[model samples]
Target: MAHLYRRRKQYWIVYYLNGNRVQESLRTDNERIAKDKKKKLEYELALGDLHQSSKLPLPMILEAFCKYMLRIRTAKSYKNEVSRLGYFLARSVTLSSLCRQGADEQRTMLHL
Candidate 1:
């Protein structure tokens, strides 16, 4: 069974999957839609068809972007492309955190 609740001014749907608790934001004030989404999530969970990677971590994505840039951008204009990429990466909360450690540290951290 799934349940809906409100917290911090947002409504969320909660359910169980393989005995693990899962939660998703409904982002609506309508209780009816919240309840309906909760039920749908629970049903999907029971069917074992959840696509978790549809939600990718930003750091992982940043690493992939770096690899892509390396393969496509030349060394002469690499700095320009890196700067542009930084702007794109900054939009992700997870990637923004990785940027704070300095570029060298971030590279080493991503390697691990």
Candidate 2:
């Protein structure tokens, strides 16, 4: 199930769709508006009108990844990897840009 949370006066919406997870950070000061947007997204997901996570903006992936890893990574080896990668990610571009770059890099590497 999807959930909503607020951090540093910003609201974030999170959900899963099409076997892939999705998230969006609404830079709104109002929690109610954030919840409304979240509900609308949930409705779209339920209707299957929203495409896979890849189709959404790349920022969503970055936010989702960090959130997921921080909350769920329990294995020592996996945690270490995330921490190491996060250092690079935190310094690089915004989550959206990083996601695009990462995806493109993966695609190119796969063809090598």
Candidate 3:
């Protein structure tokens, strides 16, 4: 259950999840807004999908996937994917470049 409390002007929330206590600020003073957020959080927690964690790097994820693929079965496309991912990692580029390139393509499409 999500508990909503007030700390001066900002509303704070606390809940016990997976034997760990999670406390987060609602960043709002309004009771209605805080209640709505508390309800949403409670619903999400019930469904076991409230992931409050950082993501692993793309190269690390790809490396783990390659290892898993090797353990399961071999495929030509999978091998190619591993090779391509390795080349990208060896180049030591941040993944934001890929995001920027996709955004640029979308901008061009919009301009057309």
TM-score each candidate. Answer: 0.49, 0.44, 0.48
Could you tell which candidate, 1 or 3, scores higher by TM-score?
A: 1
Q: Candidate 2 lDDT, tens digit per residue, 42-112?
A: 78877889875346665776656755654565445434644566677675663324345354443353332
Alpha carbon lDDT of each predicted model:
0.64, 0.64, 0.68
lDDT of 3: 0.68
Q: Roughly what TM-score does model 1 have, to 2 decimal places?
A: 0.49
Task: Tell me how candidate 2 scores on lDDT.
Answer: 0.64
**After aligning candidate 3 to the native by TM-score, how far in Å is the CA of 60 from where it should be?**
11
Ordered from best to worst lDDT, the candidate numbers read: 3, 1, 2
Assess the local accuracy of residue 107 in candidate 2 as a C-alpha lDDT between 0 and 100: 33
Tens digit of per-residue lDDT, candidate 1, span 37-62: 77777777778887554467767666
**lDDT per residue (tens digit) for residues 1-112 in model 3:** 8899999999999998778888999999999999999999999999998976545876565545655654565455544554576576785643223234343443353342
Model 1 stretches astray by more than 4 angstroms: 8-10, 53-57, 72-84, 90-112
